[model samples]
Target: MQTAQTVMMVRPAAFRANPETMKSNHFQKSWDGDLDVASLARKAFDDYAASLRAEGVEVRIIDDISSQETPDSLFPNNWIVMLADGSIFTFPMEAHNRRRERRMDIIADLSHDYEVLRRVDLSRYEDKNLYLEGTGSLILDHDNRIAYACRSSRSSEVVGREFERLSGYRIHWFDARDRLHHPIYHTNVMMSIGTRFAIVCLESLSSESERRELISQLERTGKNLIDVTFAQMEAFSCNVLELRN
Candidate 1:
């Protein structure tokens, strides 16, 4: 899919470390019950939005309602996704609070610029404990119609197949583990795919066959693979995202 020149962000109102999500999310730290998390989160949110605007990118910031208390609202890309053909997808979130992050008003606002042909509601799968947290669960190689994913607590083959059937993307999945041998929570946290470049933590893929498949696919797709070690992936090197200017 073509990258959007415009991006959407949520201004957090009750942002804090989520207890339920912290188990799978390695980047999240448990708050020691002392810091002014809300205020700090707001400042960071504002600064990040300002930086994006400085780069000549249009950012649509939607204020998160306090009633929702969605701690991960800032990561809107997890609940909602927009396809190149104007298909809007609402995914099921692993955490209950994260599910509240999905807002129909945002879709209404986005429709002003993008043609929303239809909505694919995969939230029903959550009832079965089959979670697929939007772009967080699957990284799309849109041009090649491939959905790259690493199965974990928040993502699964059941929902991955659903995504493939609905979005018309082929699923390419492998098991990825952290240095501690724990499953990586989200696929986006371990790999990123771009038009001409791919950054991945090959060490995370324990199976050599899976690692080779990932490399072979990247090479076949004409992407320059930038391999990173487990330590580098911990530094957020594999968590790269591309934006259109």
Candidate 2:
């Protein structure tokens, strides 16, 4: 399936901006005041899960371990991805602390409902300084068997190729930059691929050739392209996921 009928979410016990991720993830911002960020985050998470459940979407909530000190545990997609083929792939994270977010118990929990055929652990590449932060680095076009990725420290070409070989998906690798000309930390930050539609910031691509190729492929695969400006992309217009109800 291109989209999932069920989704999993992590409820944070100590939600705060991660200092390690702040180096490359420009979208993250540190709080200025003594706000109870964790409380606010919990409230938002509950509201989001409630809304999804109201829409008939099966939402699985996992409480984050308070003693783990994993500030970014809320984003489970960055560490592990469950594929339609009953395979789970664990990716290497750019931030050292984020690696701690991976837990076998979560996989075991998911296996109760879903048939997990196999587990692929690519985290070993971290020892070589190569990283691929799961769905963050890849915007997968499952219908077309394509994996779109932007080259960044968090998304290495070596790992992308490895994923391509393992997952049997064609990798369309490209370079994408923010308005400040720095490489976009994640592919999902500037583009998203739905079943029959795609939201993309074409201007973020480094070269016009890459943009043309991307557009051509999307069109070929019957995607209705929705191009967003740099401002809209920075506002997270492209950071969206379409799930089956």
Candidate 3:
């Protein structure tokens, strides 16, 4: 689906800066010692969901269970993705605690609104320490059947190939890094695909060849590439998602 009228958001119970994910996630800010980070996160989540609901968007708010200890539970996009064909694919997460964020009950609840044709489980890759963080790992151009991914420890060629084999999406893989030359954790944080436009941090791509190839592919797929700088990427400008009302 190029645009979705409905979205599911998890209201975090124990939301805080996750130490396990901090090494890879440069975008996450460390919680200050004086502030109640969990409380702040909960308030932000509630307000965000409320704002979406007020905008006439159908927001499915699921409360995260405190006992789960999943600090990044609010980011449901990392664990599960639903395709237009009604296939719900579950992915393997690099962080063990993040893996616990996946809830079968939530998938069951989605059946009330969506026609789930099949459930594809790719979590088996976790046993081999190979992971693909769902939509976060892949910036998919649904109209073109192209899956653009920035190769990272959390997202590798092995699982990317498997995703292509299962979803029939051709993988356009590239190596992207931050200004510090550290690998970008998730593709979604620096690339986004919409029907008419693509937000991408071409500067983050390490190679000129890869940048040229990505631009060529995006143009061929009829997307106007809105190239962003590394600084803008760090500010989360490329992390935009499209929603249709």
**Model 3: per-residue lDDT, tens digit, 165-190?**
99988999999999999999999988
Count of clashing pairs, candidate 2: 0
lDDT top scorer? 2
Preferred candidate (TM-score higher): 1 or 2: 2
lDDT of each: 0.88, 0.92, 0.90
Q: Please provide, for model 2 over 1-245, each residue's C-alpha lDDT reduced to its tens digit, 9 standing for 90 to 100.
A: 68998989999988899999888988889998988999999999999999999998999999999899999999899999988898899999988888989998998888887898989999999999999999999998887789999999999899988898899888899999998898899999999999889999999997999999999999999999999999999899999899888
For candidate 1, give the lDDT: 0.88
* Candidate 3 error regions (>4 Å): none
Q: 1-245 in candidate 1: lDDT tens per residue?
A: 53667888889998888987988887778778778989998998899989989998888899999998888898888889888978999998889988888898888888877788988989998899989988888888889988889999899799888888888999889999999899999998889998889999999999999999999988999989999999898998887677887
Which candidate has the top score in TM-score?
A: 2
- Arranged by lDDT, best first: 2, 3, 1
lDDT of 1 at 9: 85
Each prediction's number of clashing residue pairs = 1, 0, 0
